[model samples]
Target: MKKKKFLLIVLSLLVLFAGFTLTKSFLVSSKQPAPVPTSVVINEEKAIQNFSKALTYKTISFQEREKFDLKEFDKFIAFLKDSYPNVHEKLDLEMVNDYGLVFKWIGSQSNKKPIGLTSHYDVVPVLSGTESNWENDPFSGAIKDGFIWGRGTLDDKIGVIGILEAAEYLLTEGFTPSRDIYFMFGFDEEIGGDLGAKAIAEKLKQRGIQFDFVLDEGGAIVENMVPGVEQPVGVVGISEKGSATATLSIIGSGGHSSQPKDRTNIGRIASAISKLEETQFDGKLRGPGNDLFEFVAPEMNFGMKYVFANKLLFKPIIEQILLKEPATAALIRTTIAPTIFQAGEQYNALPEEASAIINLRLMPGDSLEDVKEFIVNTIDDGEITVTVTGTEASSISSTEGPQFEAIQQAARNVYNDSIIAPYLMFAGSDAKHYDSISDNTYRFLPVQISSDDLNRMHGTNEHISIKNYINAIKFYIEIMKVTNQQ
Candidate 1:
């Protein structure tokens, strides 16, 4: 009788556990359905034509500084004034550092904190030899085959032109916000936003201005980026990875290659790098990575959903699965890339010094000093001199509350079919500069694009579909309407 009672108790416990697991799986998706844009009507052909014309200006940001097309930038500024006469006429416009633009639309309620929408007008160069690879002259801004082909169309000009298109439409319709709205455009974001966004932030700081939120370009609507979720996920970047370069240098006794030591400088440096690659940062699916799965797990299939919903018990398995792809792997940890390796110039000579530069994208909690220590400890070689320098990751913006909700609602109004979620950005953007002057910052461009199109952002044949561009304009209109209501 005692043994039979014990067996019955065990069966009851198993049943309770299964029931709890099933309950959590069903409750995984807290995402409410996004509202559709029922009343927004935009001039589709005119919006497309305006974007195509904006792409023609070669306002490229070359690292060398001298290669900048100031003339084209001048023309682009003029184009903005001409294209959106209503905006230029009504909003208070100011120029910063010659090329940057700050346009403020005064709100009815002066006491309410202002909000900002920013994007860089500058674009990366069409790498010299690959210009011919484009389907059209990258600067020509050709509209053909249902796509607008050009350099800036995807990398950023979309943000500038899209925002302006919406604002112009709203102004023409005589719609004004209850709270102030600022449109900031930076010219140097392609290199580092120092001259443009950094300067703009400082100017705002001196004026005693603080924003409720600032939106800039970073994430996009991606198809098949996440597994098991059939709808395109619109990722709004709540934070971005920090970038740093760690140099591993070694100095040993000079010797001929013929009579090399067991552990020469070259060998030591190579070993250090090998160890770095072999033992990467301990990958943990926590913080933003965990939150992302939490948001999307409900949309995943039964097998994947079961694993993610019971994350505490199944974390190890989830981490292993995420680590399988480099892209997803980057979402979890500080990534290391061996960008530059330098050693002896001559083939025959093995002089004294050897070095390698590893570029790292830091996680939010990682301090630069701690990263340096982690590298030295991992390599465990006294001869290897590791020097580290890079920016720390941006502070994690709030994923909860009205700021994010406004963004989601705006996006959903246009692309109701896509699943919108907050995510951490792998790349840096001008959004980082606004951290101090705003209550919050969000990075997303309401554009429906594929991974193949994403690759073309800084590569050849860059373009955006006409349908996507039209939807982008409409999305902006909705964002302004919804957020201004807040």
Candidate 2:
């Protein structure tokens, strides 16, 4: 009789737990209905012409600074001045560090903190051998098949020209911002942004100028971005991963190829890399990656919604699923990419020293020292010299408040069918540099694009559809207006 009573008690507890979980899932939705979009009119013909013309300049950023052509950059600057006369005439412009452009539109309300829009003009150089793969010349900015084909069309020139065009339009409409607006363009974002964004940020910091928010080019609107949601999703990057380069090197005795030792320096380096790969950084759904799901759960199908809403009960299962894909896996943990391997120069000789460089995109809380220590412990090789050097992850920005709401509403106004969610950026951007000066820096490139288009960035045959280009301008305009009202 006592045994039967204990079994009944256990079953009742299980039933209650299940009931509570289902109820919680149903009530967990945090989605607020988006506001009605304010109609924005832009001159599509003139905007396209300006965007196409801006891409003609060869403002390419090369790893080696000496390879840049100052003439092309200078011409691009001149073109902007010729194109947007209203912006040049009304806003105060300063050329920081020569190529870095800063324009300030003094606000009607001085008590309100300034807001910033930033993007880089420099683009990555196309590979010499891949030029034939392009249907149009990468630098030609060909308007073919309703697509603008060029190198910088997607990587970032869109942000630079889009923001300027919107500003020019607003000025023409006799609209002034309630808060001061600053437009900043960097010249060397492709390399490290040290000369461009870093310099501009330093200058702003010295002036004791703090921004309410600064928006830069990053995550974009995409279809099938998340697995469960059917509508297109626009991801606003609330934080970006820190980039670190770790070098693993070993020195050992050199010998002839025919009689090489069992453990050569090259062998040690390769083995170390293999071990690091097998033992990756811990994948946990915390921080921005976690925040992404909370915002999207309400829109997901019932099954996905249930699993995500009760993460405490199903966290391990969800993480395992996220770990299955390279794309999704990056969201929850730091990533390891072995980019450069250097060892032997000759065909028949075993070099005494071998070195491999592993590039890691660190999670927000993962410090440089923590990453280095993790690498050292994973390899378990006392002989291998491990050295890590790079900047730590940028501070995570708040998803709440007017700063985020303005961006979310602006995106919704332009792409009403899409859901806007905060996501962690796996790659680095110039926005990280601005974090020091701004209270919150958000990375969102206001364009609807696909995975194929993303792959084309810094690759052959890069292009943006005409429709995407126009909407990008509209988003900029909306963002400006919405931010002021907030």
Candidate 3:
């Protein structure tokens, strides 16, 4: 009788556990029904022509600061004034730090805090030999085959021109915003936005200006990007990973190659790197990474939805699946990549010193000093010294409330079928700098693009479809209108 009662109790517990999970799966959902899209009409031809023309200026941001062509940037600024007369004439324009452009559109209500729309105009330079790979001239800004071919067409001139075009159209329609809107354009974003965006952000902070939210170029509507979700999903970055560099160096005795010691400088460096790779940063599905799965779980097929809904029971299984792909793995944990390895100069002679640089994208809450200690402990070698230097990850922005809802609603109004979700950005953006002055900072590039298009960014043959460009402008207009209502 005792044995039978014990078996019955075990059976009851198993049934209770199963029932609990099934009930939770049925209750949890992140999916929202598609809303009716608001009608927006614009002169498609003129907008396309303007965007195409704006891409012609080679305002490239080179790593070496001396290579920037100030003349081209000046011409680009002039082009903006000439193309959008009303934006320059009506909005208060200030040239922050000479190249940084700040345009403030005063609204009817002064009580409401302002919102900012920002993007960088400068683009990565076309690699010297890769020029031949482009279908159209990299600098041509050619409008053919229903696409505009150029570097900045996608990387960001889209944000600058798209916002201006929408603002110009709104001015023509005599539409005044309920709250103030500021459009900021940075010149040098590719090489760490220190001069352009940082200066602009500091300037605003000095004037005691605090914003409700600031939107900048980042995640976009990607098709076939999210696993198990058939429809295209637009990802807005609520937080971005911090980019830090860790240098591991060693100073040891150099002997003749013929009578080399068991361990050389190069060997030690290689061993340290190998150990770090084998033992990577512990992966945990939390923060923005966890938020991404939560948002998409409802849209996933029954099997995936069930697994994610019962995350408490299946968290390990889900993490194992995510860890399978490098792209997906980056979403969960801080990533380490050894970019530069330098050692001996001569092939035969033993080198006295060796150094390797590991590029790390830190997850939120991971400090640079902590990461350095981790490296030092992980390597476990006293001979080798480790040093880490870079900015910590940006603060996580709120996904709730009207500010975020305005962004989501605007995206839905433009792309009715796409699911807009908040995510963690693996790459960095200028939006991080605005965190000080803005209550919330969102990183989203309002365009529907594929993984291939993402790869082409900062690569050869970068371009944007005409339809996508116009939709970007429409998104900007919708966002402005939606935020005004809030």
Candidate 4:
């Protein structure tokens, strides 16, 4: 009788523990509030009109950059002043690097560090004959069938106009932030931002002003961006891959084609190139990949959820599957592609020297020295020489911090149905310039875009939906609220 009583007591304790665990899980999941309040209304027509008018200016960044008619940039600035009178009156604006514009909105309090929101005004030069691909003139800023078409519609002008609209609206509504806000607009981001964002970052550094968080243009919303996710995914870039160029050269004895030695200059260089391609850098899921899964895992289907939920157990298999697709492959590993090859000048004579240039995108944990060593060890050719030069990848920002969560929550408020996940940006951006002075740098373009829209960004037929322009403005407003709440 006593033994039966002890068994009943043990079973009761086990049941109680199970109930507690389930209740805890439920509470944790339910604690997060609904992403956005439905009460806030957006003026879609006005936002689209402003975005369309902003795109009409021909502020293309040229590589050689012949004296750009500063008059046009000046006109663009004046147009902003006229269009957003509230923003102009409320925010203190300063011009950096001749054309770069920075606006500071002093907050109700100044104890916390400021947050920066940045975008570039300049667009890439259109190729001479590619204008035919455009549905309308690239600079016309045509609004037709609920779309605003033009260059800079998607690249970055959307961000510039969107933030201004939010600020204008907030100022008119008598909303003030707890922390200071800065809107930084760079003029030459398309041409590497040397005279624009870089100069501004340097100036800020001199002033000893460090930002709590800096948000810039990088990734966007697109369908099928990830292989398995059905919803249109919005990727926020926490870090960007560094770009480097590696040069391989081999010098050998010149001889007649018929009497060429077994290992000539061309053969040695070609062999080295082949070796490098065959032996790529190691592939593993880490950094931004982990952050991406954390955000999307809750919304994933059963099968994807299982894989993502137990990532430590399924990492190798997940990586193998991701490697099969080129687009997905890039996310998990560094990439290498040969861009230039130079060899023989004549048809019959063997060239004295041959060289090849390889472009590499460095992952977060990898460095230029690591790349050089990998090339030398893999090729193992004594006569062939390899040289590498470029910037190493930037440091990864924390995903757990309040800054990241604030950005994610703001994105969710603007894009309620879409998932906001952090990932590494394959392309470089102006945000990289501010990494030295900021604790958290995030890259996100607050616009819903299709995959084809990405091609049109620096290409032909660049455009954005009227709905997306309004959403971009809404996102900025939500970000302001989220940032201040923390």
lDDT of 4 by residue, 205-312 (tens): 998879999999988877776655677788889999999999999887887898888888988888888888888887888888767876776666656765666677
In order, what lDDT does every prediction score?
0.89, 0.92, 0.92, 0.84
Best TM-score goes to which candidate? 3
For residue 306, what is the lDDT in candidate 1?
A: 82
lDDT, candidate 3, equals 0.92
Off by over 4 Å in 1: 1-10
C-alpha lDDT of residue 270 in model 3: 96
Kindly list the per-residue Cα lDDT of model 3 for residues 391-436, writing each as its tens digit.
Answer: 8899999887788888888898988889888899988899998999
Q: For model 2, how does the per-residue alpha-carbon lDDT over 1-486 read when each residue is reduced to its tens digit? A: 999999999999999998998898899865644766758888898999999999999999999999999999999999999999999999999999899999999999978999999999999999989989999999998998899989889989999999999999999999999999999999999998999999999999999999999999999999998988999888999999999999999988887899998889988899999998998999999999998998999999988888998998999999999999999999999999999999998889999899999999999999999999999999999999999999888999998888898998888888988889899998789999999899999999999999999999989899999999999999999999998796
The C-alpha RMSD in Å for every predicted model, in order, reads 1.4, 1.4, 1.2, 5.3
TM-score of each: 0.97, 0.97, 0.98, 0.91
Query: What would the per-residue lDDT of candidate 1 be over residues 1-486, giving only the tens digit for each residue?
Result: 999999999999999999998888887765645586548788888888888899999898999888897999999999999999999999999999999999999999969999899999999988989977887999988999999989888879999999999999999899999899999999999899899999999999999999989999989999998888888999999889999999999887877788877887888888888898899998898777777887788888887888789999888887888788899899998998999888887787886998899999999899899899999999999878889998999988877878888888888888887888888899999999999999899899899898898899999899989988888888888888987788
Model 3 scores worst on lDDT over the 10 consecutive residues at: 29-38
**lDDT-superior candidate, 2 or 4:** 2
Candidate 2 segments whose C-alpha is farther than 4 A from its true place: 1-6
